[model samples]
Target: MPTGLRASDAPTLQRLCGSDQRLFLRIGQLLQAKLAFTEPALGEIVGNEALKKLALDKRMREVDATSFATLLAEHGGDGDLVLVDGEGEAGWRVIAVVDELGNPLLAPAPAEVGGAAILATLSPALRAPVEGLLHAGGDEQRAAALEQLRYAAPPLSVVSELMPMLLADGAELVRERAINLLVAAGAQIAVIDLVRALQRGDLAQLGRIADAVSNLA
Candidate 1:
């Protein structure tokens, strides 16, 4: 029960919190304005009893608890709830749980890690989504994606898949992180590619990539 939210607001909040993307955007904007001021508002949205119950209900359908737990842990902490709809003859559907403030409770880690692991397992079909998260906006999301990449052990044939991103435009921290992971994973060809990029001055990345390469030799 966040301050300023009346009992009358509950129903509307519940509906919006269910799966409303626009409401989420609005909440994101508000939170960006000031998290301290918005905490109560966020608490109200994330703490909704109905939403929690729905998430629990959705969790019951998962066949794998480890997968479910990972997903829940990733997205749940962010205040986003994931709902899997469809049962019996219907197919399962994913619904993002948004708090009243519109922040998704689900963290991006599980998806990133799971997706990367799937890729490492050579399931080409799962690569795109996992790679997509590598470019996700938040530092935490990018970090999670990079951590997954670190663990992927992708072969040289697939090293190209991640090369572009490691050199793409992003925060210095992200680029540095990517470089470190690639190096540690013994992505030799990828490192060579990065070295080429650095030599051509094609990548305006942080000084760390160059430093990393220097140490590698």
Candidate 2:
């Protein structure tokens, strides 16, 4: 079993230990260098060996108070930090929280400690078709991929890569699907661009914007 200091541990320490009493600890024992933190609400998963290996592979260094505190603040003080390995050229290592269905509450930004490629999740299978959709391609193939993305959300980087051209696609069907997928993916920038498109006289985008508003509601 892995034992460590967590965001919640501070309060527990305060409750158990007097302020004047010096309580000493070490990161090696408390943080274990290879474990992750999950709040009780999600259930206990401490000392997860697979996650420890994943962390080591990602080159996750020792957990210092500063890093732990920073991550805690970033996490809004409560949640799990499950380490998951990334795939493809732009691989990433993330210490992140997930919703009940296991979706990342926010996208993990590549950390400077581990410099990997740019788009971490787009493997060859995904990269080929996403690139094809973004670049020169038949409208039918692009439309098909755009529709598929609603169920299988691509990495945010891929979504960003496809946004410019697809949003302005000449084919109404392709453009509409692209907008729907973007909205579903919760891309705030997509809504901003949709509004901009309307300002630029693309009145056709108004309905998509309305749909996005309804989704938000």
Candidate 3:
């Protein structure tokens, strides 16, 4: 990844970090590699115990142990920094982004997020429930759907469809919430897919993607 998350991203990043400007700025550092990952970049997770255990057992890897920038500068992200889920970008689920050290910058998420391991294995039918909640469900149902978005981190087929409408939500809080979900969705999109999409787009669209991913000042 390059250093280029746009200024427009500021609002969403700030909101996602509970308006903690410092934490949001740190994320900026990680995204832009202002403090790129150092050697021995290891992975750690902040989900529930099960996810942690899975991280320890199934996901651990011994690497060159160096600064993040040097690693990427020399070798590139061989799935070391990004997370993937389901098939294609539509089903991608970003777990965590690492810091200047190769250590993953795990997020503080709901206990249910630990279930992401299992959820990612589900069939595409997961969208059916999300679709119902977005279209017909009442307040409680909508809230439930948001939880799914926040923790479960389902496929984009469902997530992509719900977001545009949510972004248009009239209430300020609702729109902010939608923006948060949109940010997560962006993470789900693979860089390769993003590049392909850009190939089909004009220069302006390409610039937007560049800004979205690596908008360094």
Candidate 1 per-residue C-alpha lDDT over 1-217 given as tens digits, one digit per residue, 9 for 90 to 100:
1122211122233244444433332332222221111234334445664433333343334423245446556444443433323321123232333352333453334544422644655655436545665447787677677667556655555544554434342455666666655565566543554444442344343133434433333
Give the per-residue lDDT of model 3 (tens digit) for 86-195: 32223112233444223245332453331233344456656444544456445555655665655656655545545434432334455455445555655433333233
lDDT at 49, model 3: 30
lDDT string for model 2 (29-133, tens) is: 222233323332112222343333333332334444346445444434433543443321122222434442243543334451121232355676566555445
In candidate 1, which residue pairs get closer than 3 Å at backbone N, Cα or C atoms, i.e. clash?
45-100, 74-107, 75-105, 75-106, 75-107, 79-105, 80-104, 80-105, 80-106
Q: Could you report the Cα RMSD, in angstroms, for every candidate shown?
A: 18.8, 17.8, 15.5
Model 3 weakest 10-residue run by lDDT: 33-42
Q: In TM-score terms, which candidate is top? A: 2
TM-score of 2: 0.32
Candidate 2: deviation at residue 217, Å?
Answer: 20
The TM-score ranking, best first, is 2, 1, 3
Q: For every model shown, what is its TM-score relative to the native structure?
A: 0.30, 0.32, 0.27
For candidate 1, the TM-score is: 0.30
